[model samples]
Target: MNTVKINWPNKKSSNCSPGVDWLKAAYDADIEIPTGCLGGSCGACEIEVNGEVVRACIATVPDKKELNVEFFSDPYW
Candidate 1:
């Protein structure tokens, strides 16, 4: 199985298989991605993947060689 290289917001890196849950991938990288709803209703788990913002709670790692992820910063949060 091909794995993807993830560059987390905290500068930590981890190798996870494609299609892996975003939350699990982040956890494996020793990073914490705040999540309010696991069903993708809340915006707490929002993150930027390869410059595209996505909800981590309802998204998975795409099939790519490398991915750069950034946490979404909400001023009201």
Candidate 2:
């Protein structure tokens, strides 16, 4: 399996199986992101990857190269 390194907004590094736990990666990144519901319906774990908002809870983990993700705390509106 390929190891994927996720670069978070706060500059933290973590590893997880592809399409597994993207949320844990963000939390390990030392980013104080918030989520109302752990479930993937509340839309609270939304974050930006370059410039797009991706729900960390549902976002698939990277499988090949490490991905760069910039998360927004209270990023809504």
Candidate 3:
């Protein structure tokens, strides 16, 4: 399986499979990414991945050279 390096906002990094669940991978790396709905219906689980805003609940890790991910916070979530 192919793997990609994910860099978190906390300055922590982890090597994960491209098909892995983003939320689970983040959690395994000791990073807590807040979530609301597990599905893609709600926008509360949105996150920034490689400069793109993606819904974590419905998005999977991608195969990339490296992934820089940051949590997307909404004042009114």
Candidate maximizing lDDT: 1
RMSD to native for every prediction? 1.1, 2.7, 1.4
TM-score of each: 0.92, 0.68, 0.88
Report the number of backbone clashes for model 3.
Answer: 0
Residue 42's C-alpha lDDT in candidate 1?
88
Alpha-carbon error at 26 in model 3, in Å? 0.7
Query: In terms of TM-score, which candidate is stronger, 1 or 3?
Result: 1
Q: What are the lDDT scores of the predictions, listed in order?
A: 0.90, 0.69, 0.86
Candidate 1 lDDT by residue in tens digits, 1-77: 99899988778889999999999988888899998978999898999998898999899999999999998887897
Residue 1 C-alpha lDDT in model 2: 75
- Tell me the lDDT of candidate 3: 0.86
What is the overall TM-score of model 3 with all chains considered together? 0.88
Clashes of 1: 0
Q: Least accurate stretch of 10 residues (summed lDDT) in model 3?
A: 68-77
Off by over 4 Å in 2: 28-31, 73-76
